[model samples]
Target: MDRITTQAPALVLRPWDPADAVDLVGLCQDPALRRWTNTPVDDEAGAVRWIQEQQRGRAAGHRFAFAIVESRATSSEGRLAGHMVLKNVTPGGASAEVGYWTAAHARGRGVASRALRALTDWAFTTFAGDGLARLELLHQVDNAASCRVAQKSGYELATLLPAAPPAFPRDGHLHIRSRSAQVSALVDATRR
Candidate 1:
């Protein structure tokens, strides 16, 4: 494992690296990520492209993505357990939306919750000097796990933004969860 970045009791969240392409490909291949996020690469070339784009996105400051690494009882340090990507970030920017997926082998172990909390905390403070007001998670209403993550991350149900599904066979309903006064309260309560 590389040096721990955003450390909690058992996990570390750090920026994505170009060298992480292979593991990232494997991470994206998890069925859960495929169902919720954009499709994973089917070939090495595609994975390479995705990794390059992520690197570019990071350099351009248009988006930020991090790997969620965790320590296991058997491992001395931490290992990449998942990924978290935050898009459209700017100080006092209208809003930043977060997306994440846990590794297939690391699900249901509080990894997502811990990472989300850390990410949200960073988002909240990143724009404190500016007028940045809130963060949001635009989730498909049917994705209960993500809804839980959003809730745990200090977002409250703000509104529903409706749309059509990509395949056109299904209706798309987008639920928007926003960080508001309640989130401030959550921050106060959770901050040590």
Candidate 2:
């Protein structure tokens, strides 16, 4: 399947573009975002490279990286809120990993949670035919806030990956949300 576009009340997730470099750099400046995630707002050059990589990833079909942005802003004045990506998508495509962050100012407003839910819904719905079995979230163990977000989004803690993966700076929580479970939970919520 091709990359998808997801929208929520506060934000829209679209394919990343080169023009997003400036706002993306600003969003990555939050130390909290950088410390736990690989996102670094080092320089314009870095942003340029990231934009290029997003394009390359899309072309290669290994990833889908979106530019999380506000819905109301004109493109020229729109802020780069952050990003959400679905990576390591399988040939069966039923499984994928999600990662996301919001700008420092956007924290606590449920942006990340909403974005995660939106993406999860899309992933399960759109990729179900591809054996889309499950989706997972990875977060540092000390990041209680993120853990809460995952819980709120209906992901259950699956394991404590003892060793930090090469890309992770430290050991963390590995949470999983299976498609059938997610659908059942959503159905239950709507019935109440």
Candidate 3:
């Protein structure tokens, strides 16, 4: 698959490149980032492997992972601000899971929520003809910031999920944002 480059008012989201391994390693260094999500990127080698996984996932059309950067970035090489992915998509599937994380430098600045909105918009636009109906975003119960991001992205809390030990160590919230709901919310947001 060709690389995807998406944009929002404040962001430019492109495919994860091997060149971003250094930035990934640095972003993964934040304890809060590590504690909130599980991506297994602790070092440069891990970062490279993770990036390859993203590439492979894209090739397989099972996931679309994006490296988020500022649209008007200061550096020639846009500083990596965050990451987002639409994972677990099956061919002509009705739903897909979305996940994201923001670097410490970008936290509390609406990066996650805005990038997620961009990704969600892209997913629905790109996959709707394939029967995509909704996006699911899950996060551990303790992740208040994540919960906020979900809400801001117009995903409503749908259900509670039990902890799956070793993988999901805590109870989680499953949020759902359907295409109809997203359209309404987006229209409302634009109106406001």
Candidate 4:
């Protein structure tokens, strides 16, 4: 698996490490996060398992999970701020879904939005040759914050999926960014 990094003005998105388990456990304890995301890091062991799963996904080329950390001048710097991932990569590699959660302390700081933008841009360019043409971000309709993040990251609201059993038990909004020729041409024509 290739290690990838994306730097933004305030944050750096990098691959997860086993050492992040401590912070991951803390993040999972946030009530807001637990409510909005299906985070499984309830204990040290769960955190370890989570990190291991992330590694497995990366090795399988099915997911790229990044730890969002604050950038500092020194090597020993800022702690874990959040996490963002591109998952559900299609067989042809043309599309993937993005998901993210911000730690309690990182809320209202634009961390999620910044990380999302950096990851989205990196994924689009870095994986273009591997058939990555589009990215999708879905959030439950009530998650206004996540919707804001998606919009801020340049994803357009595509559709509202009906409440489906098993996966989406509630109505969800799907946002998408496309690199397809048709979409590009449309964007270009609109700019002219």
Measured against the true structure, the TM-scores of the candidates, in listed sequence, are 0.79, 0.88, 0.91, 0.87
lDDT of 1: 0.68
Per-residue lDDT value at 92 in model 3: 81
- Give the clashing residue pairs of candidate 4, or none: none
Give the worst 10-residue stretch by lDDT in candidate 4. 1-10
C-alpha lDDT of residue 136 in model 3? 98
lDDT of 4 by residue, 6-70 (tens): 45446877788999998899888989998788777889999999999998998888889988888
lDDT of each: 0.68, 0.79, 0.87, 0.82
Question: Deviation in angstroms for 154 in model 4?
Answer: 0.6
Q: Spell out the clash pairs found in candidate 2.
A: 94-131, 94-132, 94-133
What is the number of residue pairs that collide in model 2? 3
The alpha-carbon deviation from the true structure for residue 185 of candidate 2, after best TM-score superposition, in angstroms, is: 3.2
Q: After aligning candidate 2 to the native by TM-score, how far in Å is the CA of 76 from where it should be?
A: 11
lDDT of 2 by residue, 9-77 (tens): 557778887778877777777788887788645888899998888778878866788877766644522
Per-residue lDDT tens digits of candidate 3, residues 1-192? 333444444577889999999889988988998898788988899999999999999999999999988766554335789889999999889999999999999889888888888888889988988999989999999999999999998899999999998889999999999999877877997998
- 55-76, model 1: which lDDT tens digit per residue? 6877876677777878666774
